[model samples]
Target: MQLTILRSQLLSGLEKVGRAVNSRSTLPVLAHVFLEACDNRLSFFATDLETGIVMPVSAEVKTPGRTTVPAGPFTEYAKTLPTQAELTLTLKDGKLTVKSGASKASFATGDPGDYPPRPTLAEADHTFTLLPGVLKDLLRQTLPVTATDEARAILTGVQFDAAPAQLTLRAADGFRACVAQAGYESLPLAPFQAVVTARSLREVLRLLDGTHPEAVQIIADQQARVAFLLAEGVIVFAQTLAGEYPDVDQVVPKTATTEAVLSVEAFIRACKQMRVAADKPREALGRLDLQNSGANAVKVTAEGEILTASETTLTGDVTVTGQSMQIALNLAFVLDMLEVIKTSHVRLKANAPNTPVVLTPEGVPGLLYVIMPMVGH
Candidate 1:
C-alpha cells in the first residue's frame, strides 16, 4: 500500500477506527488496523470480533494495495507527528514504512486477506433510515441502563423495536429501565428488531458523532449481524445477542400509591449529601424519608447517622420515621440518572416500602425511572 496524506487527516482516521481495535485479545490480527488505499482514498478498518469499524480519509493513492499494522503503535506515532506534515505510507515485503518530515518508522505487516470479513445484511430484507441527531439523542437517554455483565447477554444490548410509525429503544440492567421513542415517516419493511450490545452501539455512535453524518442506514437480518452505514467514510458491524429481552413494560408499574413532586436539583443535592455518609460505612447505609404534608410540598430527607461522626439535625420538622436501608449502591449511578432526567421538577412514586420507586418529570409523559428499594434492616 502506498499513500500520501496530511498528518491531521491520517491521525483523525486512525483515531476514529481505533475505537474497535482490541486492546487485549488472543488474536494478534484483532490488534491491527487494516489500511486499504484505493480510488483516491485511504480506509482504515478495525474489529474485535464482536464489533467492527471502517473510516475513510482523503489521500493521494499512488498504488492501490492493502496492509495491516499494529493499531496502537501506529496511532500513537501518528498523533505525535506535525499536523501540517505529509504522511507517506509504503508497504514492501512483510514490513510497512511510515515517513513524515524528519521522523521515519517501520512496522511488520500482516496479510490483509486474513482479516475477518465485514458482515453484510440483505438490502431488501431489512433496512431503516434515521436522522443522526435524533438517533444519538435516543441512545444517550437509554444506553446507560444496559447491563455490563456477560452472563445476562441480552440485558447488555439495547433493544430496538419498530412498528408502524414509531421506533423505540429500550435498555435495562435488572435494577433500572430506560426507554426512548421517535417517530418515523413510514413503517420499516422488515420490522428490523434486534438486541445489539450497548458497547457496540456506543462505539458506533461515537464514530457517527465524529463524522456528523446527516442520516444513518441501519440493516439487520434475522439471526445475523447488523450493519450501520453512516456515510462513505464510516461503517459499523455488531453481532446481535440471541435471546429475548425481559418484558420491561410489565416491570414498570401502572399505578402509584405514593407520589411526590420535587426539584431535580434539590433531590440530586440531597442524594449527594447522603452519598458522602453512605460511602464511609463498611456496609453503606442511607435512608430516604418522603412524606406529603401539604398541597404544594413533599418532604425529602437523606440521612446516614452510622457513618457520621456527629449528630446532624434538620432545620425542618420530621414527618416520617427514618426509612433506613442497608443498601450498597454505587453513588455514581444515582448521579448519572439525575443528570439525564430532563426536567426541574421530578415526581417520585412508590407503591410500598419494599417496592421499586419510580421517578418522572412533573409534566413530561414518556420519560420514567424506576429504582428498586433496598432491603432495610
Candidate 2:
C-alpha cells in the first residue's frame, strides 16, 4: 500500500476505526487496523470479531494495495507528527513504513486477507434514516440503564424497536429500566426489532460529529446477526445480541396510587446531598416521602454507614390527590434518571412502596423510566 495524506486526515481515520481493535485478543490480527488504498481514498478498517468500523479518509493513492498494521502504535506515532504535515505510507515485504518531515518509522504489517471482512447487511429487512442529533438523544436515554453485567448478555444491550410511526430505545438492568422514543418515518415493511450492545453504540456516539448534521442510515438485519450504521465518512457494523428484549411497556406502571411533581434541579440537588451521607456508590439508600399536605413539601432522608443520618425537605408541587406515601429506593438509580431527563419538571409516581416507581418528564410524553424500590429493613 502506498499513500500520501495529511496528518490530520490520517489521524482522524485511525482514531475512529481504532475503537474496534482488541489489542488483547487471542488472534493477533485483531489488534491490527486493515488499510486499503483505492479510488483515491484510504479506508481504515478494524474489528474485534464482534463490532467493526470502516473510516475512509482522503488521500493520494499511488499504488492501490492493502496491508494491516498495529493500530495502537501507528495512532500514537501519528499524534506526534506535526498537524497537517504530509505523510507517506508504504507497505512491502511485510513492513509498512511511515515517513514525514524529519521523522521516519516502520511497522510490521500483516496480510490484509487475514483481517475479518467488513459486515454486509444483505438480509436487511428494515432501513431507516435519522439525524445525528436524534440518534444521540435516543442513545443518551437508554445507555445509562444498560447493565454492565455480562452474565445476562441481553440486559447489557439496548433494544431497538421500529414501529410504523416511531423508533423506541429500551434498556434495563435488574434494578431499573429506561424507555425513550423518537418519531421516524418507517418503511412500508413489517415492524422490526434488534438489540445492540451499549459498548458498540457508545463508539458510534463518539464518531458522530455534531457540527455536521448529516443523516445517518440504519440497516436492521437481526437475521444476519449484525446491524449497519452508515454515516458521512464511517460505517459501523454492530453485532446484534441473540434473544428477545423484554417488553418494556409491560414493565412500566399503568396507574399511580401516589404522584408528585418536583423540579428536576431541586430534587437532584437534594438527592446528591443525601447520597453524600450514605457513602455507597451503587446502593445508596434513601427514603422519599411525598405528602399532599397543604405545604407541598417532599422529604428525603438517608442513613450513613455509621450512626449518622441526613434529612432534607424540598419544596415542590403536589398536583395529584393521594394519601401520604413513602418509598425506599436506591438513590443512585434515581439520580441517574434525573441527570438524563432534559425537562424542567419530573413526575414521580408509584402504585405502592413495593411496586415499581415510574418517573417521567412533566411535558415529555415519550420518555419514561421505571425503577424498582429497595426492600425495607
Candidate 3:
C-alpha cells in the first residue's frame, strides 16, 4: 500500500483503532493494524474478537493495496514525525515504510492472511439515532453500575432497549443499578433490545466529543453484533453478550416513605468528609440520617465508623413527607453517583432501611440511580 496522509490524521486514525489491538494475543497479526488503501482513502482496522474499530481517513493513494504492520511502532513513530506535514506509507518486499520530509522508517509487515477479514455486515434488523450529548449522558449514568463479575455476564454490559418511543439503558451489579432513557424521533418499526459490552460503550463515549454534532446511528443485528456508526465511514462494533439482564424495575420502589432535596455540592461535600472517617473502618461504612428539621427543611447527617467517629448535618428545602429514615451505605457508592449528577440539587427517595434508595438528578427527566443499602456499620 502506497499512500500519503496528513500526519495528524494518520496519528488520530492509528490511536482510534489501537484500543482493539491485543499485544498479548496468541496470533501476532492481532497486534498489528490491518490497513487497506483504496479510492484515495486509507482504512485502519483492529480487533480483539470481543470489540473492533474501523477508521477511514482521506489520503492520496498512488497504488491501492493492503498491508499489516505493528500498531505500537506505527503510533509511536507517527507521534515523533513532523506535524502538519504529509506522511508517505509504502509497502515493499513485505516491509511497510514511513517517510515525512527528510525522515523515514520501515517496519516488518505481518502476513495479512492471518488477520480476520472485516465481515460484510448485513442490513440491520433494527436501527435508531441519538445525539452525541444525550448518548454520552446515558452512558455515564449506566456504565458505572454494570457488574464486573463475569459470573453474571449479562450485567457486565449496558442493556439498550429500543422501544417504540424511547431508548433506555439499564445496568445493575447486585448492589446498585442505573436506569436512564433518551428520546429519539421516528425509531425503528420493531422494538428491539441488545446488551453491548462496557468496553465498547466506553469507546463510543470517548468518540463523542462535545464538538461533534453528528447524531450517532445505532445498528443492531438479530443476535451476533451491534455497530455504532459515526460521522464519515467510521464504525465501532462489538459482540453482544448472550443471556438476559436482570429486571431491576421490581426493586425500584413506586412509593417512598421519605424524600429529601439537597444541594448537590453540599451533599457531596458531606460525603467526602464522611469518606475519610469511613475508610478508617474495615468495611468503610457511613450512615445517612434523614430527619425533618423544621418547616420546609430536612437535616441530613453523614455519620461514619469504628475507627474515628465523624458526623455532619445540613438542613434545607421542600417538604419532608412520611417517616424519618436512616440508611447505612458505602460512602464511595454515593460519591460516584453524585459526581455525575449534572444539576444544582439532587432528590433522594427511600422507603425503608433495607430497601433501595433512589437518587435522581433534579430536573433531569428519565434518569434514575438506585443504591442498595448496606447491612451494618
Candidate 4:
C-alpha cells in the first residue's frame, strides 16, 4: 500500500476506527487496523469480533493496495506528528513505513485477508432514519441504566424498538430503568427491535461528529447485525444480544400515590451535599423525605448517617398527594438520572416508600426513569 495522506486526516481515520480494536485480543489480528487505499481515499477498519467500525478519509493514493498494522502504536505515533505535514505510507516486503517531516517509523504488516469480513446488512430489511441529535439524546438517556453484569447479557445493552411513528430506547439494570422516545421521519418496513451494547452506542456517538450530517441511517437485520451509518462513508456495526428484552412498559409504574415537583438543580445540589455521608456506608443509600410544607411547596430532605441536608426551594408548582413519606434509595442512581434530565423541573412519583420511584421531566413526553427504593434498616 502506498499513499500520501494529510497527517490530520490519517489521525482522524485511525482514531475513529480504533475504538473497535481491543488491546487484549487472543487473535493478534483483531488488535490491528486494516488499511485499504483505493478510489482516491484511504479507509481504516477495526473490529473486536463483537463490534466493528469502518471510516474513510481523503488521501492521495499512488498505488492501490491493502495491509494491516498494529493500531495502538501507529495511532500514538501519528498523533505526535505535525498536522500540517503530509504522511507518506508505503508497504514493502512484510513491513509498513510511515514518514512525515523528520520523524519516521516502520511496523510489521499482516495480510488484510486475515481480518474478519466486514459486516453488511441487506437493503430490503428493517431500516429507518433518525436525526443525529435525537439519536444522541436517546442513547444518552438510557445508557446509564444498562447493566454492568455480563451474566445477563440482555441487560447490558439498550433496547432499540421502532414502531410506526416513533422509536424508543430502553435499558435497565436490576434496580433502575430508563426509557426515551424520539420521532423519526422514515419508519421501517415493519416493527423491529434489537439490543445494542452500551459500549458500542458510545462509539457511535463519537462517530456522529456532533456537527456535520444531521441524519443517521439505522439498519436492523435480524439475520445479521445492527448498522449505524453516519454520513455516507462511516459505519458502526454491533452484534445484537440473543434473548428477549424485558417488557419495560409493564415494569414502569402507571400510577402514583404521592407526587412532587422540584427543581432539577436544587434537588441535585441537595443530593451532592449529602453524598459525602451517603458514600461512607457499605449500602450507599441516601434517605429522602417528601412532605407538603404549604401551598404549592414540597420540602425535600436528604439524610445520611452522619450528615443531613434539607432544601425548601419553592420549585414550580409542587403538589403532594397521599401522605408524607420517606424513601431510601441509591444516591448514585438518583444522581445519574438528574444529570441527564436536562430540564428545569422534574416530577417525582411513587406509590409507597418501598415501591420504585418514577421520575420524568415536567413537560417532556416519552422520557422517564424508574429507580427502585432501597430497604432501610
Which is the leading candidate under lDDT? 2
Model 2, 234: alpha-carbon shift in Å? 1.0
Weakest 10 consecutive residues, lDDT, candidate 4? 308-317
Residue lDDT tens for model 3, 250-361: 7899989899888889888877777776545323467887776555454333444443566677665445666777888776777778888799888989999998999898
| Model 1, span 121-201: residue lDDT tens | 654367778888777777877888888888888999999887657788888888778767786533577676788889889
Better of 1 and 2 by lDDT: 2
Backbone clash count for every predicted candidate, in the order shown = 0, 0, 0, 0
Give the clash count for model 4: 0
**Candidate 4 lDDT, tens digit per residue, 121-233?**
75538889988888888887898899989989999999998888899999999899998999996777788888998888988887776336668889887555889989748
| Most TM-score-accurate candidate | 2
> Model 4: what TM-score?
0.93
Reference-based lDDT, residue 150, model 3: 90
RMSD of each: 3.9, 1.8, 2.3, 2.2
Alpha-carbon local distance difference test for all models = 0.74, 0.84, 0.82, 0.83
- Residue 15 deviation, candidate 1, in Å? 0.6
